[model samples]
Target: MLDAGIYEQLSRLVIAMKQKSSQNMAGNRRSVQKGTSAEFSDFREYMPGDDLRRLDWNVYARSERMYIREYFEEKEAVVSVILDTSASMHYGKKSKAELAQDLCAVIAFLTLHHMDRLVLYDSSQMGTPLVVSGGKNALPKVLGWLQARTFSGTETDSFSAVRQMQRRGAGVTVIVSDFLTEAATDPTQDCLEKTMQYLDFTKQRPVLLQTLCAEELRVTMDGTRNLIDMESKEKLRVTMRADVIARYEQELQKLSVRLKKSASAAGGTYILCDSEKERRALILEDLRPLFV
Candidate 1:
């Protein structure tokens, strides 16, 4: 269950942030772009200063008056929250899966409070789209859908999921995941580079890559144990030698650097969150900076 006090605080935080920033919660600034609105977009001459793009060809064909179409301000921006509920997300001291859900709930509530449309999806066992709406009252349904979802042993296809979701229209696509997919030949570089292709697709705008974890930035595994792949159900027993642990830490840092670089290159925001922290500070101090 979500904490009511934290939810209320984050809602107010989003409102204040929107008010303070030049950026509006809606997709774009007020424009004369033709859309399904009552406001007149603009008038164009019978000729080409008019966008043949927005030309009322019907009016031109009938009255011989070549008036281009005009549009009104788009009211609501669609904000889609893609939450990763794969079994891998359940492996952490604070439980990454729960943190991902909480983050999703916070974002959904904030977007609805701002009158933006919200679409929620979980890509665990399979890609399951939960709900899409502009109603703040739908919070219960959203929360319930997430609450009822169990972490199953399923592989996450980030590339495929993002590709499919790209058709949902662009606004803000916030992906919350641990991002620990199977490594490739190049391991750190290959996984990130391939994943970034989907994020850079033309359809979506301002992708926010938020990685959640229960472990600290620097992970220190206690002792020798069996490491298992939650999705594949494969296990390996190994001892944590000092030098081996050092190398592991080095690789982890390299992975973080690669992820940050890739996200920046795609013109998106990346946030790393440890689920054990205070929720208020997590939003205000850590996650809020991404919006700015």
Candidate 2:
């Protein structure tokens, strides 16, 4: 969870950051102000002091009309934090589950602090998306809703929640998840492609955040054991050893690398978080720079 001190600093840092100039901004890209980017948002009748370079020469020549590009200021951004509550999320360390929840709390708190429209979505239960919208004052309510949630004890599609969500307008969509689901034959490619397409179609910027426990990075268990699937309750018997653990580590690294690359290819921010790190450290080192 976000502390009061860190909250204050993050609030100012994100809200006070200068808006991007529209004149040089690309079309369909996010900027500090809505419609301020030089990307043609709209056209208006030419007025005195209007930049001549912004005049639509083609329109004037074809229709004998005088018009200049008009850039409008973007209003308050809507920040939606999408969380995955899959059974796999519960499979990891207790700290991993707590950290995931903490991650959600921190991001939502920052979004609310910035005075943007903040909506929280969790897919632990399929079909029904728990959404709460409000300002910083509603932080308590959001946290309460999270506390009240009981995962269905079944698995779900994290991306399905994203597809069901309606974009109020173009804004930032942050996905917080373990990215492990039953639907993916290839978790990295399928999840990234589908998510990127959805965000692009909705005209919202994307931010992908993945949380993995230490066990996934480096195995600590040894000897013969029956590994139980937290969600499906299935069992797999295996003998743990140095070589097995090493191979697991190597595979996990490959998965992380692919997810990071996919995030970049989708034109968004990709961050891999260790569940063991302090929340404040994660915010300052990983999150603050992206917004500030």
Q: Scored by CA lDDT, what does every candidate get?
A: 0.62, 0.65
For residues 56-150, could you state the per-residue lDDT of candidate 2 as single tens digits? 89999999989776556544556667777666776555455567777777777766665465667776543454444346787888778777655
TM-score of each model, paired residue for residue = 0.75, 0.74
Candidate 1 lDDT tens digits, 118-234:
777777533456544545687888888888878775867554566566233335667787766654114634655665655556434334444555453555676788988888889
For model 2, the run of ten residues with the poorest summed lDDT: 16-25
lDDT of candidate 2 at residue 181, scale 0 to 100: 57
Q: Where does candidate 2 stray beyond 4 Å?
A: 15-74, 125-134, 182-189
Runs with alpha carbons beyond 4 Å of true place in candidate 1: 15-71, 125-128, 183-191, 194-198, 201-203, 206-218
Clashing pairs in 2: 20-32, 22-36, 22-37, 22-38, 23-38, 33-74, 34-73, 34-74
Compute the lDDT of residue 240 as modeled in candidate 1: 73
Q: What would you estimate as the lDDT of candidate 1?
A: 0.62
RMSD of each: 7.5, 8.9
